[model samples]
Target: MRNLFCPKCSERIFFEQGRCARCSQRLAFDPLLLVTRRLEEVKPCSNRDLIGCNWSADEKSRYCCSCALTRTIPNLGSTKNRLLWSRVEEAKRRLVYDLCRLKLPLKSEANQLSFDILSDDPEEGPIMTGHSAGLITLNLAEADDLERETRRVAFREPYRTLLGHFRHEVGHFCWDLLVAETQLRGPFRLIFGNESQSYENALKAYHERTDRSYDRAAFISEYASSHPWEDWAETFAHFLHIVSVLDSVAGLPLSLESRALETLRDPYLESDFSALLASWTPLAYSLNELNRSLGLGDAYPFQLSSVAIGKLHFIHMAIQNGCGISACGWRAAPVPVG
Candidate 1:
């Protein structure tokens, strides 16, 4: 993620900062431009500001762009809903930031697969999505840590965090990109199998089956066993997860201040998986050691299968080729399986 700052005060700002600390200026993020600017400079937008949006008007915008994605928001009168909505908005901004950096296509509110947020209850009820509309909706209630943790355990997930959600959904977006293209679609289907299968039935079968053994030869994670499309999405999310984590721990900087900035800009994804594993293996050990000292769980809790390694290498190649950059100045295609 890009390290953002308060333009007015130059104060280091958190990704979710609504107001600058030093300058106290109202801040707004332009997801398309991938920059946060002062709200005062922005002109009024045509869209109803019923949702608590902080986006500023742009040269190409009829409304504040971030507000454009929200189809519905939680009721503001409820304090719990408001707080949860705030967190969702913050995470959504970071997700948009990464998408912009990657030059990924973002669906507008008018299009299918566009982002939406809504809520009805704080527990077991909130935003509904994953229907055929291609919408990625967030239930505002899930933003509460306690509520989310409860749900996470109820769902039997080892990890369930905001970043994970963003990465997973982005996987769905990538599937849309690759599977919709004639050149890539055939290859995708060949690797992932026919996506026309009933998704609900597949999920039901996955839950009902007693065999918990994951097909390590074919999938990236145990959860990937749920379905063919899920297999791809899990792998895709893991690809991003590895890249982002590796980016964070790349190298030592002059100091803490410099380290944070450098971690945000380092080229962890611009190397082959072989080299990455070489670096990450030792680093993950060291990370676990430090976590152990702190009494925290292992930061990464998966054993890298040969198959998984191959998939990582493919992801490495994809990003390198997609960005038109050579991985560590190397000029060869990596031999990795799907």
Candidate 2:
């Protein structure tokens, strides 16, 4: 979420901007450069004309890097589905932007990362939004603000959004790519639990439990306690949340007189885990207070305990070492479950 500017006029632009307001020039995002550039007719994506996608495309592949990852989209023939699909695509683009910034492995012919955006049609049965292998499936019905809010309340979740879903599901995909076979699995089990435990039984137990007592300081959410895989996914999603939000805040010239903010580094490339937590803890507290002042709920409701901090550190190390590598060694024995 770095501040973007129009190359032609130096006017500030947004990530989703299709044109520069000051220069009256068409704009497109260059994923390789991670910047907005003046749109060139010869390089425009095929989707540019149809869906207002302002991204450059390769000569052989008419789809942009982000759009190319989409394996299935909702029915475009229906007006409602078209709008929902566009919103879903926007969230996906942001997710991809962050992933690329972190230098994570993206989709390729040999190792593909794809998505399926489907609507919850009655005839299609219930659409369960989740990720498997490298393919992430999303329920397009989440695009409707009211519907999402309703489900959020029903689930008793403090936060839920299309972007959050993408982050969480991508977390599952990354676990497969980076952690499942790696030596990190031992440490992962030490912190999260035995991932080999029956996932279905864990989920059923979670739902059937009458006692709602949860160690909020340890787990990001109640759903995270359902299984070790879920715990990893939830923790991974929060890691993305912390880094992305911190990156955005770093771009802003805040008048706060804090040394942590003064020495803020790029969270995506940050090597020191403690420094990130030191800066983020205070910043997140202030943000929550600001939200309260504005009559909104806490911006970040979860608190990181010692155990949670250890888990976050594990994620940091995993991303730093696992990127672009096929294997980081594997551990046959599981550690004591948490």
Candidates in order: C-alpha RMSD to true structure? 16.2, 18.2
How many pairs of residues collide in model 1?
1
Q: Which stretches of candidate 1 lie over 4 Å from their true place?
A: 23-25, 43-54, 59-63, 108-111, 120-131, 243-338
- The lDDT values for all models are 0.62, 0.78
Residue-level lDDT tens digits of model 1 in 42-127: 66344324434566655777665555565666678877777677667655655555566566677533345456667756586545
Task: Please name the candidate that would achieve the greatest lDDT relative to the true structure.
Answer: 2
TM-score for each of the candidates: 0.63, 0.73
The most accurate candidate by TM-score is: 2
